[model samples]
Structures are given as structure tokens and as C-alpha cells.
Target: MDQGTSKGVSRTDSVDNGEGTVSKALQGSRKKKRDKVSAYERAKKVYEEIQEEKRKERRLRKQEREQRQIATEKYEKTKRKANKMFRKRSKKGQPNLGAQVEILLEKIQQKMK
Candidate 1:
């Protein structure tokens, strides 16, 4: 006799209508899904930031290591050149050659330390 009288609710006022019930349920579900997406986005952003920081640190350490290696090589080359010069000068006297060699070795050790 009355289609709007389901469970004694009325269709004249939309508050008592099935449309409001269905819309409310959909809004609640959408809110939950949106919260989940927001949480995931925040976590992803933090992970990316941490990775970038680590990359920067690695690059800096690599640069420092290269610099130290270059310095060590230069010191070694200078020590070898000094020894070669001392050997050539040794034709004059052996005592002078020993003293010069010792000085060159000490200089090299200082740089290495």
C-alpha cells in the first residue's frame, strides 16, 4: 500500500530515505581508503630522504679516499727521485751519500705519517 513505508521510514523527508544511508556508508569507506593512501605516501617520502642522505655521505667519503691516495703517491715519487739523485752523487764519496739518503727517508716518513 505504501512503498515509502519500508521499516516505517518516510521518503517525503530525505533524512529518512535509503539514499542517505547508502551515501553515508560510501563516505565512511572513502575516508578510510584516503587515510591509508596518505600514510603510505608519508612512509615513501621518508625512505627516499634516507637514501639520498646515504648517497651524499658515500660520495664524500670516496672523494676523501681519492685525495689521500694521491698524496701518498706523490710522496713516494719524491722519495724515489731523492734516492736516485743521491746514487748519482755517490761517485764523489760514500759517506755523503749515506747521510743524504737518511735525510730523504726521514722526510718521506714524516709525510706518510
Candidate 2:
């Protein structure tokens, strides 16, 4: 209401909240601080959620590694068996068992890819 001043800066502390005290400005500043704290809290919660997801992903990776190790062991055992069987006797026109090992190796390579 004081159009008589330069740059519209009020010196009377009556620019807001009709009480004509500095408390209104203080309250506004406090509300801004509270909003900033709340925003920080929301960001912290999001960080915690991302950490939890990383933990879950690590657990799944460990489980998958164990499963792969077991499968590889089984495949190697089967390979050894076939090699031994093929070495001992050759039945006419039967497919080469070594070829099965090659196929299994190719499948393992494809899985890695």
C-alpha cells in the first residue's frame, strides 16, 4: 500500500500477515527449511529402496552362480563317462559320443552369450 517509496521496499515490517511483526518472515523461512528437510528425507528413503534392490540382486546372482557350478559339474561328469564308453567299444554306425560333448559345450557357450 506504500506506493510512495522507491523500489517498493517497506520499512514498516507490514508487508505481510497484518500483525506487523517480523515473526511472519521468520515463519516463512522456517516453513521453507521444513520443506527442504522433508525433501531430503524423501531422497534418503529412495536411496534405501535402491540399496535393498541391490541386495536382492546380489542374492539372486549368488544363487544363480551356485546353480551354474552344479550344472557344469554334472556336465563334466557326463563327458568323462561318454569318453570312457567310446574308448572301450565302438558299435557300428552309432553317433560319436564325443560329438555330444561338443554339443553340450556349444550350448554352454550360447548360455554365456
Mind giving the per-residue lDDT tens digits that candidate 2 earns over 8-102? 65556534556654555786886898777577789999999999999999999999999999999998997887676556534786767776676
CA error at residue 15 for candidate 2, angstroms: 27
lDDT of 1 at 19: 48
Once fitted onto the true fold, the runs of candidate 1 whose alpha carbons sit more than 4 angstroms away are 1-37, 89-113
**Candidate 1 TM-score to native:** 0.49
Please name the candidate that would achieve the greatest TM-score relative to the true structure: 1
Local accuracy of candidate 1 as per-residue lDDT tens digits, 1-67 = 7775887755443342344544545666767987775767899999999999999999999999999
What is the lDDT, from 0 to 100, of the residue 14 in candidate 2? 38
Where does candidate 1 have its weakest 10-residue lDDT segment?
Answer: 13-22
